[model samples]
Target: MRFATVEEPDGTVRCGVVESGVEGESLLRLPAGTTVLDLIQAGELHAAGERAQAADDAVPLAGLRLLPPLDPPTVRDFVAFEEHVEGVVQSVSGGAGVVPEWYEAPTFYFTNPYALVGAHDDVAVPPGSGLFDFELEVACVVGRDAASPTPDEVDIVGYTILNDWSARDLQRREMKVNLGPAKGKDSATTLGPWLVTADELLPYRDAEGFLALDMRVAVNGVEIGQDLLSNMGWPFEELVAYAGRGTRVRAGDVLGSGTCGNGGCLAELWGRRGAQDPPPLRPGGVVEMTVEGIGTIRNTVVAGVELPPVRPARVRPRTRKRTS
Candidate 1:
């Protein structure tokens, strides 16, 4: 079943099950004030979808604004593509393969859930940033709360296309301090078009349990790159389990499969060739991403407001200890 949250012409948000027929694509309204997360939390998402299908109030999809499939409580993004890592490492290190330690476990970072943008919303290039880029990714939403759950115990409710919008110049500085992606990445994240139930992807998984969906991305109508979801180093289950270790993950939490391999972003391309090409994304750029089984998500880049420079922190306490 496919689920989504949409805004009506009158400025009201409604949750629904998306259905496409010979006539056209339309949304079967669920109930007012109910969100995708609420249905999942109550274990009624699937059942609600079945009833929505037969309902009389089918609203045409045209003129409706898309929202994130669900309002995620938190977003955990992981580096799950070995080739993406290799290309980036080689580009930066001049000559180096992925570190052996990277294979020991999946690594991830938490991103701001409040900063999420809709599938087709306008994304502004954060002020003072010129080297903006987009990462092609796939994300899944948790279906239940769990702590230290094993891979099999991970309950992923649905999947969607994700755009990990980035400001490359800002990230370069942050990495040098070994601290944050903070303001560098906290600006915006894109999710939706809608969310498709995990079972819908069952046919797409290979014997090894890796998803085989075809993923593609384009900017301003030019295709930058394409890759298969099967190429991921670790599957979603493992990624979600790592996220839940030592902490409880609630329903509506999101886990992203990082960037895909072979030119997932402009930075990966520059690193592979040692020179920037096509330049970084800028104002007026339109990015569209499509993932098989889910759908397409597109966003237009816009200008952001400039802000005053942050005051640098003091180097140390004015009164240093006199002790040896």
Candidate 2:
């Protein structure tokens, strides 16, 4: 089943069941004041979906505005694609390659859940960033809380497209200090079109149990590249288990597979080809990403709100080295 959060013609927001294609034509409305998150937490999502299917409160999908499926409580994005890591690392690190430690376990970073952007919304180029970029990926939302659940024990409710927007210049500089991609990635993340239940994608699972979904990204109507979701070095189940290793993963939390291969971002291209051919995304640019079964999420880049200027870092002189 596919689900969405939509704005009615009256400007009322509600979660509903989207019927048919990625371009759904109608939405079977659920009750007011109830969100998809609430249903997931109460373990009534399937029941609600079944009930909505029999109701007569059908609304034209074209008359509604699609929004981010749900507001996640916490979002953790991981590097689960070996191709993406190798291409990006070598590109930015001057011919360096993926470290041995990367293969030992999936690594992830926390992102601002409040900044989740809608499927067909407008995004602003984060201020002070000249190299704005996009990452093509997919993510799964947790349906129940789990404390160190095994891969087979994870309770993933659905999957959706994820755009981990990047500010390369800011990220590159801050990461040089070995600590952050903070301001660089804090601005936005895209998730939606609709959320497809886990069982809906079962037929696409390959012999090895990896999802063989096709994924692609484009900038301003020009195709960047495409790859298989099965190419991921680790699967979503493992990622969820890994995320719950030291802490509980609560309902409504999201875990994203890192960027796909085929150069998900211009930074990787710049690293590989040694030129910024297509250049970074700027105001007026449109970024569209598609994942088979899940759906497509497209966003337009708009002018951003610039913050106050900052002074350069202070240079401290060497003074008390003998204490060591």
Candidate 3:
């Protein structure tokens, strides 16, 4: 079943299912406080069809606001696609790239859960971002706590689309200090039209299943990136297992499969070659990122004002000297 987080005309956010075609009455908005993970655990999804047909004061898709599907426990975006990694490495280092040692160990970075936006929401392009970009990815929501669950114990409650929006100019400037891809990346991250469950996607879980799904992105109506999920260098199962090692993963935790090959915004795609293209996303421009089986996420780019300066991170002095 496809599920979503929607807000009513009265302005209350809730979880629900996508009941209509990609457009009409699109969301079957659930009651307030019903989390995406809660539906999976309670098996409310099994009754979705009946619920959608019945009119029992539950909110309908037509009058609700859609939000990101889950209240995430932790959010981490991984570099699991070789082509995407290679492209980024080449652009940064100007040469062929190997999987970095950290990457071999399933590296990830935490992002602001509060900053998430839903389908059709407007994404404000940060000031000074002359090169705003988009990264198309599939995100997994963990369904249970597992400090180290065996592969079989890992339960992926559902899947959603994530756009790891990037500000290339800010990222480049910050990287010179050897700290980020932080603030540049922190400004915005988009998720959801809905979450598709395991049962609904069982047919696509085969050895050839990964390749069966198609993904694409368009600016206005022009296609920029297109590829199959099969192109990923690492599979979802391995990513889950790697992340679980020495770490506690709880329900609602999210894992993002980084940008697909050719999925970078026009800046990353064209800037490396020395072209001085302006930002791909601009005020009034529309962007649509889509994945087969899941659905499409559309956002309009809006201009942003400067945010308050981030306070310097507090560093605690070491309390003990290293014996070695």
Per-model CA lDDT versus the true structure: 0.88, 0.87, 0.73
lDDT for model 1, please: 0.88
Cα-based lDDT at residue 20, candidate 1:
91
lDDT, candidate 1, residue 234? 89
State in Å the error of residue 205, model 2. 1.1
In candidate 2 the C-alpha lDDT for residue 33 amounts to: 94
**Worst-scoring 10-residue span by lDDT in model 3:** 270-279
Residue 5, model 3: Cα distance from true site in angstroms: 1.1
Q: How many backbone clashes does candidate 3 have?
A: 4
Ranking by TM-score: 1, 2, 3
Model 1 misplaced regions, further than 4 Å: 90-95, 320-324
lDDT of 2 by residue, 1-324 (tens): 899999878889998898865556788899999899999989999999999998846777886778889888999999888778877775555556688999999999998888888999899988888889899989999989999999899999999999999888888877888887687888999999888999999999887768999999999899997999999988888899999998899988999998988867777777777788678898999999989998888899998998877688789877777665
TM-score of 1: 0.95
lDDT by residue (63-102, candidate 3, tens digit) is 4566887767678888767767666655543455555674
Reference-based TM-score of each model:
0.95, 0.94, 0.84
